[model samples]
Target: MATYVLVAGAWHGSWCWVEVARMLEAAGHRVLTPNLLGTEAEDEPETTEPLHRWAEQIAEIVRQEVDEVVLVGHSRAGLVISEVAERVPEKIDLLVYLAAYLLQDGQTLNDWAQRAHNADAMTNAVAFHSDGTCTIKPEILEKIFCNRTSAHFIDFARARTVPEPIAAFMSPIQISHERFSSVRLGYIECLQDQAIPLDMQKAMQAPFPNVMTEKLDCDHSPFFSMPHELVSALERFRRAE
Candidate 1:
């Protein structure tokens, strides 16, 4: 069984991947979904810590487990996973971006978002909180997270989302060619994603021309709207290796 480390995006915790994790585990693939530093309720604001500290958390997971892992990053988790790959490239077999960000060497998530802006599409969207933490307003959670989800799941998601750290989105990515360039990359597109938008997803894929790509006709949060399809895609990709 292949080992998979699933890192969640901003404003979300390991809770976001509970169903996905179950499916992978049922299929006998060990899955590890670590809650990023500031994304958990108990992880009090350490807005001062640099991104490398987050990357180190991921690297330590690899160091404790098998040498290499199939690293999967969803949404803003992409930034953290990429940084982890930079520090421990040897510990990653494949890097999967699940309708996620793919920032350039010096780019921040906001920089990428600016290029994909659509005021009409963003009408229901909200960014940043009073404390400078970022979060989607609960009213727009359905549109942003799982537009097609059952009302039950939508409510669960809205309640679970934490206020994301602005630093995580605004910080410039630091990558080392000696590490990142050697790993294989893959991308998944959430076709109905209003949060990132379809156009932005395509743009994110442009940088990794050779990366394997898969399209899901679902919203930004597929674990709720299309869990089976999402799990199937992940399983297929893992076995393809």
Candidate 2:
């Protein structure tokens, strides 16, 4: 059995991976999903946390365990995984980007999202707030989080999504790819994703030519709309080795 550390993107918490984690656990793999800084309303501005701090957290999880881990990152969490791999290369067996932001050295998550070449992106996407928190607009959430997702989830998200710290968005990502060059990379593309857009997903993933890319015919948040399909793809990829 392998241990899997799943990291989520902006405005999300470990709760987002509930279904995916259940499937992985039922299949006998250990899973860990932690909430990032500034995700909760009560949480203070930890988004100022340097990129290394995020990497160290993941590294600590791997260091305490003895099993090889599959580090899976979704959306902006890709930045965290890249840096984590650089910090603790030995513990990770694979790096999986689930319609995630795959970035290179000195690139910020904003840079990837705002690339001009992609035609499908929400060009006006903004993540800032006057109170110093970041959040997506309610209208944008529907397109990004899957319109078919239950109204309950939509309501919950509308009420709960705290403003993301600007640091998480503007902070430059620092990664030493040489450390993770040997790590196998995989990509799961959400073809129907309106938030990231199909074209942008393809563009975001183009840098990693060796990655195993699979298209999920669901919206951006497949974990909410099609848990089984998401689990199935994850299981297949996890067991591929």
Candidate 3:
């Protein structure tokens, strides 16, 4: 069975992957959904640690696996998984970007977000805090992220949503061709995404070499909106590899 390391995006913890993890586990694949630093609680402010530290935390988890891992990152975590692959390239079987920001070397999430058509709307929907973190406004969570998801799932996400570290978004990732290029990459695009924008997702997938691409006709949160489809796509990608 393949080992899957699932990473959540900004303002999310391992809780966001519960359904997906369950589905994968039922299929006999080992799945890990670790909570990133500063995302364990809604009240915790963003830590001052650099992005590499967060990447190291994830790398530490992957190091425990006995076999190579299928590393999956959601939303802003596309950067985290990329850095993890750089740190532990030998441990990764494939890198999957689930509607995430697949940034290149020296690029920051802020750089790509600025080019998105809904940047203004997404920025305005956030409540910036004094502690260099921000939370999405509750009133617009359904409109922006869960527009196509069920009410129960949307409410579940809204309740668990937390403030996300801004430093991670501002920090530029450093990936080397020698280290990161060897890992197999894949991208899952959410066609109806409002937060990242469909066009920007396509742009991010443009640079990867021999990357597999799949399209989900859902909003930004496909795990909640279309868990079965997401699981099927992930299975197909793994089998194809």
C-alpha RMSD of each candidate structure in angstroms: 1.8, 2.3, 1.2
lDDT of 1 at 48: 60
Runs of candidate 2 with Cα error greater than 4 angstroms are 116-127
> How well is each residue in 1-241 modelled by candidate 3, as lDDT tens digits?
8999999888777888889999999999999888877787743654575477779999999999899999999998999999998999999989999999898899999999987888899999999988888899999998888889999988899889888878888999989999999998889999999898888998898887688999999999999999999999998888884
CA lDDT, every prediction?
0.81, 0.75, 0.89
Looking at candidate 3, the ten consecutive residues that score lowest on lDDT are 41-50
State the displacement of the C-alpha of residue 157, model 3, in Å, after optimal TM-score superposition.
0.8
Name the lDDT value of residue 25 in candidate 2. 95
Q: Alpha-carbon error at 207 in model 1, in Å?
A: 2.2
For all candidates, the clash counts are 0, 3, 0
Query: What local lDDT score does residue 160 receive in model 1, on the 0 to 100 scale?
Result: 87
lDDT by residue for model 2 over 71-114, one digit each (tens)?
88887788888888887888788888887878878888778666
Higher-ranked by lDDT: 1 or 2: 1
- Residue 3, candidate 3: how far off, in angstroms? 0.8
**Lowest lDDT 10-mer window, candidate 1?**
119-128
lDDT of 2 at 4: 84
Ranking by TM-score: 3, 1, 2
